[model samples]
Target: MTNAHELGLPERVPAGDDLPAEVTVWEVGPRDGLQNESSVVPVEVKLEFIDRLADAGLTTIEATSFVHPKWVPQLADAEPLLAGLTRRAGVRYPVLVPNERGLDRALAAGVEHIAIFASATETFANRNLNRTLDEQFAMFEPVVSRAVAEGLDVRGYVSMCFGDPWEGVVDRAAVVAVGRRLLDLGCSQLSLGDTIGVATAGQVGALLDDFAAAGTPTSALAVHFHDTYGQALTNTLAALRHGVSTVDSSAGGLGGCPFAGSATGNLATEDLVWLLEGLGVRTGVDLDRLADTSVWLAGELGRPSPSRVVAALRG
Candidate 1:
């Protein structure tokens, strides 16, 4: 893994809850951002986009997802994509693994980090995971366990941490339960996802409070916000106030979950960078180059950038 100087923003962690001196951003542009495209982006395009993201100071990038092509036809080129990756010494490239099968493929590709996902609601869980909450946990118990034993950093995504379209008002109890279980099962970090972007700052406060009460340390959590209703930055500020240091954002705001009905734009990486930098929180990402990469992606995808900040910066 090569170090992306532009992405090395964790300088000095703020003491207490005052402010984080720096933040680490997980860039999901390549995997989550491109998955929903109606057109097939060439493997060359995907590789070039990743390199551009790296050049712009994105330290952590979700390179690709290893799922059945029948499910996500967009990522059918997973193997070739991984094989063609430009490995940087300090950059961390994590791949999304939907199941044990996906894990096998990731392992075959010599991947060192993998992300596994499950929703907080039954409806979303069944649709994305093809199983109930309990069943899904059973599936990951050993997968997470084995991944950890094998020295791979496993990330757990608990989607719909805020609300689900199929099941409204996700319960705080359910959120804490899944989060704790995944952490206990050997996930180094559990990313709390607002899949449909319906979360309010108050709701985010509620989740963090409950997670604290449940013995899940704040440091073990990461916020993954969607900008669907324009609450991403607000919600991120709320998370920061609560002492969370890591956030997941897509470059150019490129991804939406297919399982989430009415799911919309993700938090634009540029917007987050702007916010963090404005607050004087150290996020080593280059705001200028990131916007440039997003502009290129929006043109390549033949769509307007979901990020207003990207557009403003470009203009």
Candidate 2:
């Protein structure tokens, strides 16, 4: 288990003398964070938000989702949002696609990178997707095939990979089985999400090690955590020790799973950037700039930020 102190963060830097050989952080605040806000942020505001994120040195940002407006009304202007996006050469903008219809819309928007999500648990799948586990797999099979055919890079997100609130606990076997399928289905990378955010570092470590022992390559896997129990960075360090290089975070800790009651915002991008920069890991991100972005976003949403880093910096 990662030390509880790591799980509970304060405004102090750790001495990581021997850092991982390489690490990558994906910023998802624009899409994942803002999508849940009740205030309607306009497409122009979203575009500028993304632009500021890019300028803050985050190379990868989830732009928006192509889901039905009824499901996520916050992102209803996805089309215009994409149209207004000022594409930087090196930055890759990935949009989330719920199903075929979602992917179709994304294609029309001329997106090159796409993300699809599915649950590792059967009950969660039924609840989250309104479909059975097998049915979810069936949906991804075609999405992956057609997406690749369109020359789009697809990233798969396996939600509730570690645990499920509804089911009480998630089986590692279930995660591995679904993970292998997603990889085989042509997903270039798979991000394991603690959707309800109940993962512990020890559990996260053991799971990665188990996958390694099973002859699965762990390099293509990423960790997407929520700070529900203040464990995201702790789990991140543990995953890094296990050679898991990619991590997903949100600016200002802005995100929550609407389906799960206690799920809160994701690990703060500022916090992650500070930790990694101190560790001598080059995330190519500007911490001060990211802090400003988070603060601006909180004001835009007319709410307080969930990120401790932002609060500390604001002072």
Question: What total of clashing residue pairs does each candidate reach?
Answer: 8, 0
What tens digits encode model 2's per-residue C-alpha lDDT throughout 1-315?
Answer: 765235333334544544465677888888888887867788877888899999998889999988788878998999999988889999999999999999889999999999998889888789878989989989889999999999999999998988788787788888878888898999998899998788999889888877777677877799999988889989988888788888999999988776666678888898887777656677888777888888887888887777877777674
Model 2 clash pairs are none
Candidate 2 error regions (>4 Å)? 1-18
lDDT, residue 191, model 2: 93
lDDT of 1 by residue, 1-315 (tens): 543334433233343547777889999989998888777799999999999989988889999998889888888999999999989989999999887788889889999999999778888878898999888999998788878888999999999999988778999899999888888888989999999999999999899999999888888899999988889999999999988999999998898986676888789998898778767788889888888889998888888887877767565
What CA RMSD would you report for each candidate?
A: 4.9, 4.5
The 10-residue segment of model 2 with minimum total lDDT is 3-12
Estimated TM-score for each candidate: 0.94, 0.93
The total of clashing pairs for model 1 equals 8
